[model samples]
Target: TNNLAKTACINIVTLNSVAFYIFIMSASLPSSMRKLVVKTLTSNFRKAVEIQTVPLPNPASGHVLVKNHFVGINASDVNFSAGKYDPSKQPPFDAGFEAIGEVVAVGDGVSQSFIGKSVAHLSNGAFSEFQAVAGKSILEIPSMQPQYIPCLVSGMTAKLALQESGNLKPNEKVLVTAASGGTGQFAVQLAKLAGCHVIGTCSSDKKVNFLKSIGCDHAINISTENLGQVLKEHYPHGVDVVYESVGGETYETCVNRLAVKGRLIVIGYISGYQQPMGVATTTSARGAAALPVKMLMKSSSVTGFFLFHYANQWKSAFQELSDLYVAGKLTCMVDDGSSERKGGFRGIDDVTDAVDYLYSRKSVGKIVVNLASSGSKL
Candidate 1:
C-alpha cells in the first residue's frame, strides 16, 4: 500500500513538471508574429506580397512550432508568386518555401524533448518569424547555419536528379548548366564525386573560377566562348549526362551534345522564368516536338525532375548530403548578397531583395536570408 502511494505521488509530480514546462514555453512566445503573405499573383514579389502581423500559430496535434533562423531564396520564387507552380490555388496565401529553425514547442503526441532542437523544413509560408509544422515533416539538421539550407532543396535536387533521373555512371562525361548557381554547384561537385569529368557553364570568369575551385574539370564562360563550339571541339564524343537547368538555347545545346544513350535531366528553366508564364512554355513545346528526332539519332533521352515529386527520397538524400558536408567532402556555397547589394541580405525584410538578387544572375551560390540575429550552437 505504501509503495503504491509513493508511485502515484511520483507520477503526479512528473505530470506537473511537464505541464509547467509546456506553460512556460507557450508563455515565452509572442502573441503576434510577422509574416509575408501573397496578396496578389504577380511576378513582382515585392508588389504582390505584404508583411502582416498575425497571432502566433499554436502547434496542432503531432506538430511543432519553430522559430525560423534562416530562409532560402530560390529563383522560382517569382514563378510561385506568379502562380505558375499552382494555378488552382488562390491568393492571399503564405509566401516562401524552405527555412531552418529551432523547435520551440511541441503539440500532443510529440515528445517535449523535441523542443529546442534544430530543425529544417521545406514547406509553404516559410518566410515568417515562426511556423507550426508537422513533427515528422521537419528534418533535424546538424545546426541552424544557412549553408544547410541549400542542402535541403538544391543539394537534394542535384543528388537525386543525377542518381535517379540522370542515371549517372562512373568515369562518364557530365555537364552542368548554370554551374555556379545553387543547385548547379551541387550537381558539379556530385558529378565530380561520382568520378565523372565535370564541365560547368557560367556567365563570367569569376563564376568559372568558382566552379573550378569546386572540382569542375572544365568551366566554360558562355558569355565569352560559344558553349556548343567548345563542347564540339573538346568533347567530340559528347557528354554522358547533362544537368541542364537553364532552358531555351541551353536546353537545345545539351540535347545536341548528348552521347549515345545519354540522359539529360531538366530540373528547371530559369532562362524563361522572367518571361510571361505561357510564353516560354509555347517556345519550349515547339522545340521539344523536334527533340525526339535529335534524341533518336543519338539514342539519348530527356527527363524532367521536380524535387517535390520525389518526397520519399528526400530524407536519404539530405542525410547523405549532411554526411558529406560533415566529412568535408561537400561544399555548401551560400551567396552573402554583398556583390549585388550593400550590407547584404539580412532578416525577413530583405527576402524580396534576395529574390531579385537571385534573378539578377550575379549570385554565385545559394541565396539565403538571415532571420535570427544569433544562432544556437550545434
Candidate 2:
C-alpha cells in the first residue's frame, strides 16, 4: 500500500510540473525571445551568453549563417587583447580565429543539407552569439571526426609546424621544448607516431609525468638542471628534430645539442613575451650574447611558422592533423578558465583578462576562456 501511495505522489508531481510548463510556454513568446532559444533543452539548459541583435544580412551566394556552438580561445587571442602582435589592421572589429556553429540560414547555391550540420571554421568576429559566415572559411565535420574539433582548431598548427619543418621520418629521435604546452604535447605524440624516440622538456617535474604519459620516452626539467648534460645522457647520438615553441636560453641550450643535419622548427616566441619590469628589453633576434653558429658545425636548419599567414592553407593542416588525432596518436591539453567573464568585456574589452593571463604565464597548455561564467563586461 505504501509503495502504491509513493508512485501516485510521483505521478501527481510530474503531471503538475508538465501542466505548469505547458501553461508558461503556451503564452505567445516574442519572436526575438523564441529565436534566442534554439536547442531542445536538457537538464535545465545552463549557459550564459552575451546577446546582440544585428540586422540580418542576407547570406550572399555560397554563404551560410553560422550560429556558434563553441568558440576557441588561443594565445593569439590573448596577444591581440594586449596589443602585442604585429601587422595591425583597422579596429571597430571582431577578433577570433575559429568557431563551431550550426547553420541557421544559407544563401543561394548552398544546399539544404547544411541546414543542421555542425561546422568547424575560422573566422573573425566569433566571440558573439551569432556571426555572418563566408562559405570559403567553413567546413562540415563528418560524424567520424567529431572528437577532433578541439585539436583541429587549437593545436592544428602545432602539429603542422612540426611535421612540415621537422621533416620527421620513421624511427628518428625527436625532442620538444615546453612539451606540456598545448602544441608541445601534440608535437611529442606526432613524433612518436612517426616512430621517433621522443624527449620532452617542461618547467616543472610534475609536467614531466604528463609528457611521459603521452608518448614521450623521456622528459627533462628545464627549470632546474643542466639541459645539455641531460640530453647527452638520454640521447647519446643527439636528437634529430626539435619543435621549438618556447625560445630564449632554452633555444640556445637546444641548439647546442642538435644532431648534425637536425631541423629546428620555430613556432612561437613565448620565451621573449614576458620580462620583468626592470629586466633589459630584448631586441633583434631576441637577446643574448652572440654565438658563432660556425662553431657548432651542424647542418641543422631553423624554420619559422606563423599560422595566420598560412590562412589560405588552414584546412590542409586541419585535415592531416585530424587524421592523426582520430587514429589515437595525439592529445590536446586545455587550460580552461573564465577569462571572458572575469575580464568583463564587451566588444573589444573582452580580451583584457585573457591578455593578462598570457603575459603572466599563469597557466599551462592552451588557455581556454569560458565565456559563460565570467562576470566581466565590456
Candidate 3:
C-alpha cells in the first residue's frame, strides 16, 4: 500500500509538470508588436506613414489573431494613404491590405482548430507583425508561401473583373493595359486560358518580351509603337473586351477602340494615383458627359470593378485561382525587390521602398514584403 501511494504521487507530479510546461509555451507570445499607420494623408507613401510599437491585440469574439509572414503592396496603397479611396477616412489608420500568415489564437466562440492553420486575409493593417481579423475572412491556403499573397487581391481582381464584369467569352479579342503589371499579368493569362486572343500593352521591350512569354498574341510596346495605330491597323474591328487600369489618356484610347457591343472593365486609374484627389477625380470626370452618347453609338458599355464591393464571390474565385495555380495553368509572379532595388524588401521597414518600386513601373509582377525572417518561421 505504501509503494502504491508513492507511484500515485510520482504520476501526479509528472502530470502537473507537463501541464505547467504547456501553459508556459502558450504564453510565450510577445506583449507588443510593430505596425505601420498612416499618420498623415499624402500621396507620397513614404512620408505618409510611421511605424509604431503597441500592445499586441487579442482577437475579439468571432476573430482570430494571425502572425503575418508576407504582405502585398498595391498601386492603390498610395490612394489609400492619401484618403482618395475614402475621403472620410482620417489619419492614423492602418495602411496595408493583404497578408499571409499562421493563426496563433482564436477568440471567444471561434473554433480552436483555426490556430496553427496557414491562412491569408485581405484586411486593413496587413503591414503589421500581427493582426486580429474576423475568423470568416481567413482563407486557408495550401501553405504559407509568398506566392499566395498575390492571389488574394491581384488574382481575385483579374478573375472576377474579367468573368463577372467584363463578360469574357472564349475566342473574344481581349486587351489588357499595363499588361505586365501585378494584376495585369493575371488578366493577360486568364484571358488566354479562356481561349481569347489577348493583346497586352507595355512601355519597355523587356515588358513586351514578358507579355509574349505569357501567351499574349500581341505585345504592343507603347514606347515606340502607337497603341491606337496598332489596334486600328491590325484589329480594325476593335477589341471585344478591355481590362483598362491605367487612366488618363489611356482610358480615352481604350474607350475609343472598343468594338461594337464591347465591354470595358475599369479596375483602377493608376495614372492619377499620385495626383491630388481633386485632380484625379476631375481627370476621370473629363469625358463623363460624352460617355453615354459614345456607348450608345457602339452598343458598348463601361463597368467599374472594386474587389471590396464583391465580397461574396471572393471565396469561390480564390478557390478557382488556387486550383489553376496548383495545376500549373496559372503563374504567380512576385517581385521581391531584388531586381529593381538593393537587398530586397524584407520586413516592415522595406514596405515603403517596395511601394515606390511598384510605382516606378520597374517591377514585372506582384511586389511582396517578407515579414518573416529566415529564423522566424512559425
Better of 1 and 2 by TM-score: 1
Candidate with best TM-score: 1
Q: Model 1 shows how many backbone clashes?
A: 0
Which residue pairs overlap in candidate 1's backbone?
Answer: none
State which candidate, 1 or 3, has the greater TM-score: 1
Candidate 3 global lDDT: 0.89
Model 2 poorest 10 in a row by lDDT: 37-46
* lDDT per residue (tens digit) for residues 243-287 in model 1: 988888888988889899999999999888877667753346767
Per-residue lDDT of model 2, residues 1-378, tens digit only = 999999999999977875565455334222331012212211111121123454545568988877665555554553443335543543333455666666666688877456657777777666655566877778776542324445655567766676567778888878888788767777887788778888888877778778878878988887787788998887777778888867666777667677888887777756554432234433434434443472247877777887776676678777777666666656655554443344322232243344455445444556544333334443
**How many clashes in each candidate?**
0, 8, 0
User: What TM-score, over all chains together, does every model reach?
Assistant: 0.91, 0.71, 0.90
- By summed lDDT, the worst window of 10 consecutive residues in model 1 runs over 369-378
Q: What local lDDT does model 2 show for residue 276? A: 26
